[model samples]
Target: MASDLKVHSFEEVAKHNKTKDCWLIISGQVYNVTSFMDDHPGGDEVLLAATGKDATNDFEDVGHSDSAREMMEKYLIGEIDGSTVPQKRAYIPPQKAPYNPDKTSEFVIRILQFLVPLLILGLAFAVRHYTKKE
Candidate 1:
């Protein structure tokens, strides 16, 4: 939640490229440059090798467009510092909603559920019999 929008230079990002999905949070923007690493024209090794250093330099290396830079601002949540990065949890499964049983409420709900259909069926039967007689 820090306000200082740190823009990382490309050199710094290159240092930490080996870390796989190592991200740089800059200017309140988050860029997952992982997929772009291997195909970089500047030789993938340079970015791949920047595995551990501070990536302030890498971000600066890739200059931003006026519109892109403005859009990038939205993704920045904070830098991938040791504290934040290490604490980040791996991909977790989606959590299913818990079922809470309330006996009194459930009983009433079940009775209403069953009674509604039965009521409709009885009404239909009564209507049909009266129409046939008529």
Candidate 2:
């Protein structure tokens, strides 16, 4: 890491939020994306929506292409001071009872899974029979 690279607090990064001065933090790196807004393939609103905040999840969720990743390099301005980066809470999915095939809903869905296809096939056959030449 270059010692000269600017380090900004989250508050400092947040100060640049505007159409003409947008900045965002992603994975603790700060970027001034104001110039890139008009050129963003997703449109300026998408970029603007993430301005002044940590957009790491939103950015990663889009699954940006390698070229897009490369493009971001040009806008790199600094990194967020490690101490200032907000710690995100870990998500824990709610526990549920183990799946039971014997459940009525599951039994009904299994029955429908089998019968719906059979019914569709039967309907197709009946339609064909009725439409056949005399």
Candidate 3:
């Protein structure tokens, strides 16, 4: 059955990205969804945006219904050549932000925000006390 399906390269599928001739690669299968664009519930723009790349993740993320999945069979033109498509990179945890002097200074400013007001009040009290004695 695999022999019966035409195999398309990533580049070949990318060429049909326009509104008039849209195609998509989902789960390694190439689909010429031009006819279904207007009928697509998500709208044709969603399909257009998904072009020029492997949209397997985008397609699956939407959690399409079984009926939608079945409908795709009608548009199935071929399978994408795995060798021609770039392999997705493994997920990498984000790195912590580097130590920032600005952040340290911000902390100091916050502490001063409270302490400065308290210090001024204390100084005023000290002056009042001396003036009362005079």
Candidate 4:
């Protein structure tokens, strides 16, 4: 770290976000990328969208080349106050609810399918028996 590198709070860095005045924080380093917006292969929108938050993941996810990494030096303005940036949340698997056979619609449908045909046959037999001559 250069002794000349100034430190900026997250809130302070966030306010510079705009097409003509954008800034980004990646890996705790603050960069003034306003001038580089038009030249960015990803376009200004990509850089603009990265503002107002820690963009380390966004930056790393792209797998920037060594030349791209070297190019970042020209845009480097300062270092961000790490304490103010939000930490990335760890992945937590969702809890699975136990399967309840009694609550399933498939169970009700199966019961109805079996009973409906039996009920129709019983009704038809009852009608035939009642209508027969004594």
Candidate 5:
């Protein structure tokens, strides 16, 4: 059940499928997240967790989380299960203009942490400009 609310255990997640670019069928449906395995922000660990298993709970667990789910949406494209498999659309990195803060705070925090020194340097420059006497 893609909409199931019950969270799957980590062990269950790990048993799903670990293969780098393989698709798994569950309950007559196909979920083609294989191409996204290497591109996942958390790296291969997240994709490995959902291999070879019914990943409804895993989807809930990750999407329920702020950052994980937000990141997950970037890779989602409806259900890809069955003989009517959708065309393999080229992966397009979604560009969000003005950079929405709707992304997970953890990602935001990581970015901010990386930028803090530059921010401080800018502030120092500003302070020096304002305080210098003629």
Candidate 6:
């Protein structure tokens, strides 16, 4: 469907990251989404936040239905130039030793995690108890 569309450089797309001129890249395709921002069911900020960046992951993560996908076609402006598209960095979670419930530091953190919330709850109850109407 996009066979005849002109390719746009990332630099060109990035220039449109404002409310009145927002653009987005999704799966290497560039789209002028300024008009769609206000119409977005998720609200304009979500679409605006994705402006000037590849939003394929965020788009797919939301599990948008087929109708949403079809709606996006109307906004397609061009393909992002392959050489100019930014490459995503591979994620490597920090390697940590297996969690040990018995470790002193881990035990302390676990106690704090539990006690902090419990303490807050107790304090709230105390305040409510003291402030109750006669």
RMSD of each: 14.2, 10.8, 5.4, 4.9, 19.7, 12.1
Clash pairs, candidate 5, are: 13-49, 16-51, 16-52, 16-53, 17-51, 17-52, 30-81
At residue 115, candidate 1 shows an lDDT of: 100
lDDT of 5 at 68: 53
**Of the pair 3 and 6, which is ahead by TM-score?**
3
- For residue 1, give model 5's deviation from the true position in Å: 20
For 1-134, candidate 4 gives per-residue lDDT tens digits of: 66799999999999999998999999989999999999999999999889999999899999999999999999999999989887779999999999987779888999999999999999999999999998
lDDT (Cα atoms) of all candidates against the true structure: 0.57, 0.88, 0.94, 0.93, 0.56, 0.88
Better model by lDDT, 4 or 5? 4
Q: 1 or 6: which has the higher lDDT?
A: 6
TM-score against native, each model: 0.30, 0.62, 0.66, 0.66, 0.32, 0.64
lDDT (Cα, tens digit) per residue for candidate 1, span 21-117: 6554443244555665665556666655445444446656877468755654454534543433323359989998776568668998999999999
For 22-41, candidate 5 gives per-residue lDDT tens digits of 44433334444677767666
Order by TM-score, highest first: 4, 3, 6, 2, 5, 1
Clashing pairs in 3: none
Off by over 4 Å in 5: 1-18, 24-28, 64-134
- Residue-wise C-alpha lDDT for candidate 6, range 22-130, written one tens digit per residue: 9999998888888887888898889888876788898999999999889889999899987887777999999999877679788899899999999999999999999
For model 2, give the 10-residue run with minimal summed lDDT. 1-10
RMSD of 3: 5.4
Model 1 lDDT on a 0 to 1 scale: 0.57
In the range 1-134, model 2's lDDT, one tens digit per residue, is: 55666999988888888889999888878989999878888998998899766899999999999988988888888889878766778999999989876797888999999999999999999999999998
* Clashing residue pairs in candidate 6 (N, C-alpha, C atoms within 3 angstroms): none
**Candidate 4 runs further than 4 Å off:** 61-67, 105-134
